[model samples]
Target chain A: MFRGIVFAFLGGACITLQGVANSRISHDIGTWQAATVTQLTGFIMALMIYLFVRDGDLGGFRKVKPLYLAGGAFGSVIIFSEVTAIQTIGVTFTISALLIAQLLVTFLIDRFGWFGTTKSKMGAPQFIGLAMMIGGVLIMKL
Target chain B: MLIGLLLAAFAGMMVALQTIFNNRTDVHMGSWATTTWVLFMGFVASLACSLIFEGSRTFNLQQMQPWYWFSGLIGVGVVICLVLGIKILGPTFSVSVTLTAQLGFALLFDSLGWLGLEKVAFDWKQLAGVVVIVAGIYVFKFGGKKKSAEAVQSASAAN
Candidate 1:
């Protein structure tokens, strides 16, 4: 439990850090080029890590759905849309909308068991918790 | 403004979608291998787009600072952690926790004016926001302890 929380927390921190850094890189290179560079360096780093900590079989890729391979395609879209939104609407509104949107989509995914995920009904506490979380974000941004 | 808001939401959807896709990919391969594969594919796609869209622009790497390169490395961390996190915490819970941390750090950076951002004063509202988010998580996890574990199991199993 602790490990999961920590993992989620660290992942979140990295998201912000990477975004700020990527935007900075975009200022230096063009937006798309910055993305390419970020992905390239990230790929290199992942390749290095995979060498030492190779636990899973690479051949397993053949077992997964072909559509799953397109995850990286969405990665590019995430970068392009996020940067443009921030630039257009200002950071506060952009981030607020983003948080809400993420919560809504993720909650629906959890409820409906989308993409082969387990369907977990949002109990009263979970729903309230989500609402509070969303409220907190709105408060922070507004 | 509406378009901007829509774009932000669209980005959020892409993020959620990408995460699940990565998690699905992780089911067959090791986390690191999945990360490597995703980044490799992303690199190719983005490289192609960059060539097509940015062919005319020449980047002068001479003035580029060292820290700019670190984003990709940080991205490696993000993917690994999310892969682990989603497996354990499930999709919504994992992402909610992550989003909290993301916002918290962003708030801290904004307040401290780190990363070249203009300094903003930290006040009670920010503190309340953080506190409420923490409270929400606490409520969702421990407050409903009876259901939480089963919820987690089902989510992971289904994934």
Candidate 2:
């Protein structure tokens, strides 16, 4: 539990960094260019590390099903779309949209057991919590 | 502003789904391996998009600022931290905490003008929202039935 809390904080910090970086990048470069370039750089870095350590077992790239591959594609699109939106809508709004979207996706995926994972049933509290989060997000922007 | 918020939310939710997928399938490959594959995929996808959308635009790495590079590094760090954090903290809590922290940092940066954001005053409503959010987080974390019930029983016994 202690460790979990630490992880939570650290994760939060990292994400904050991402937000700051994204904001800065958006100001500097075209939203698409910035996002794509950053992702590419990160990808190259990750790939390099893998090459050095994994002894050339790039099989994970090949092992997954086509739909799994689609996850990556979808992720890119979502990221680019959000970044573009941030330029027009403002940061708070963007973040709020993201939070609500996350809650909904998580709820559905959990409840439906999509993508070969076990389903997560949502209680009333969870639903209420999701709504509260969405409301808060909107309120923050407003 | 509202539209931007919605877009950001949509993007975040998409990320969440990806995370769920990662949790399910990532065990087959360790974090290092999984990160590599995802980054590669993202790279490929982004590159393709860039080509299709912005044809003939030379990507002159030399012309880019240091922030761009730092941004990517930060992204890598975030990915690692998020993966590790999700393992320790459940998804909902992890995401909430992360976003809260992001907001906290964002405010500081905004105030300091560190990230090129102009100085903006934090109004009463923003403060109230922050406080309310903190309270909500506390409730979500400690107000669970088991913990609350245990506390109530212990207090009753003492009384």
Candidate 3:
């Protein structure tokens, strides 16, 4: 549990770092080019790790649902929207708004068991937690 | 204006959905392979989109600084960390913690003017916001501990 929190923190830091790097690259190149380049580099790095680990079978890829394979496509949309939103609304607002939106969708997803996820009903505490987080984000932007 | 905000919200939804998909894929393929597939597929999708929308103008590779290339490498860290996090922390907890970290680091980055971003002076409001967010996470974690634990157990049992 402690380790999970630490990993989650690190993951968040990586996202911020990636966002900065992406913005810099996008300024020099076009947004799409930057995204494509970033994806390519990430692919190469992951491929290298895969080669070293040699854990999962190539055959497993064929067994998974096609919808699962569309994550990358959604990633593309995320990049495009994130970059554009930041430019339009500033980083603080964009991040805050994104968080709120994310929590809302995540709540619905969990409640409904959408997208192969298990249904977990949200109680008052969950809602309060989400609201507090969103409030924090808004305050931070102010 | 509102449309842009709506788009941003949609993008956030996409992010949540993407994580779900990636997590599911990770169960089958392992983290490294899953990351590889995601990046490769994203690269293909972005490339096609770039070609269609930007056309020949999209290829400006020579103008970019060498350091800019590190974004992709950092992306590897993001994928691996997220997969590990979700596996352990579950999606909501992982994502909430991640957002807190992202906001904190983003504020720091802005203050330092790192990575081509213009410097923004640090404000107490932001600090307060960070505190509130951390508090919220604490509440979320402890308040719903039993429920989340049960959910996690059930999820693993399902698998």
Candidate 4:
């Protein structure tokens, strides 16, 4: 329960800034450009932090493989686009749409065991809840 | 209009992909390592696309201001927090609460005209939308039926 509270609070903070960051990226560069740059910047920062904190050597990176890297790139494009949408559709609506999109995609992925995700069974509640969430996002559109 | 809608939908799909990948990768690597790989790879991909389409001449670092980099750094913090939250709490609960909180924060930021953007006043449609979204999240959180007999029996005794 305690961990859950901390998670909720941290998640709240992260989501709070997500809109501002997205809006900034949109204005600073073209949607695609901003997304790409942010990813690079973020990646550089993360790598530097790892180097200083972790005792492991650079050899571990060689094992990362190109396929995983490509996967990351594809994911980055999606993230960048989503953030850009927040500016156009407002945060509330964007998030609602995101929830629906995520649920459906997750179902597909899990059902088919795509992208290394676990092959889990989707319960009835999960489907209904996802539908309700999507319906809510649609309502927000109005 | 339809084009824009489709693009947004596509972006939403991307976001989901990122989440799942990040979730899986985070297990093997720490958040920083995972994030670095994601961002660095993304940058390389973008650069390649731009260079191929717009040519190598498109690589102009001078065009970007310092503030642009600062904005990216801010995003780094946001990502770390978000990842931490997701790791600690399940994605469903974490995303639901965060989305609700984000709406409130984004509204406040928009109202203040901070970050040099045009100010948008609160309106009825926006207000109603936010309320409905929040309600929906709560409903989604608690709407599930009974769990498996084993889950129910264990869950009850655990508390």
Best by DockQ: 3
The residue-by-residue lDDT of candidate 2 on A3-114, one tens digit each, is: 7656666656666556656666756655556667777777777777667777334565466666654555554676676666645654444554565576567557656667
Chain B, TM-score, each prediction? 0.66, 0.71, 0.74, 0.72
Off by more than 4 A, model 3: A1-7, A140-142, B1-7, B83-97, B145-159
**Regions of model 2 farther than 4 Å from truth:** A1-4, A51-57, B58-63, B86-96, B110-113, B133-159
Which regions of candidate 1 deviate over 4 angstroms?
A: A1-8, A87-96, A140-142, B1-4, B58-63, B80-97, B118-123, B137-159
Candidate 4 stretches greater than 4 Å from native: A1-7, A10-16, A55-66, A83-87, B53-63, B86-92, B107-120, B138-159
Expressed as tens digits, the lDDT of each residue in A1-142 for candidate 4 is 4675565555565555645665665565555566566666666776777787773433345555445445567744565556566666555555556556655665577666676654555566556666656665555456
lDDT of 2 by residue, B1-159 (tens): 556655676676667656655543355565556666666666677767767787656263455687677566666666656555556765555645666765566455544555665555655555555555544544443333232211111100000
| Per-model lDDT | 0.70, 0.57, 0.72, 0.56
DockQ of 4: 0.38
> Which residue pairs clash within candidate 4?
A39-B39
Let me know the TM-score candidate 1 reaches against the reference structure.
0.79
Which of candidates 1 and 4 reaches a greater DockQ? 1
TM-score of chain A of each: 0.80, 0.79, 0.86, 0.76
Model 3, B19-127: lDDT tens per residue?
Answer: 6776677678866777788888888988998999999987857897876666788887776676678789876677667778877887787778787676778788977
TM-score of each: 0.79, 0.80, 0.86, 0.76
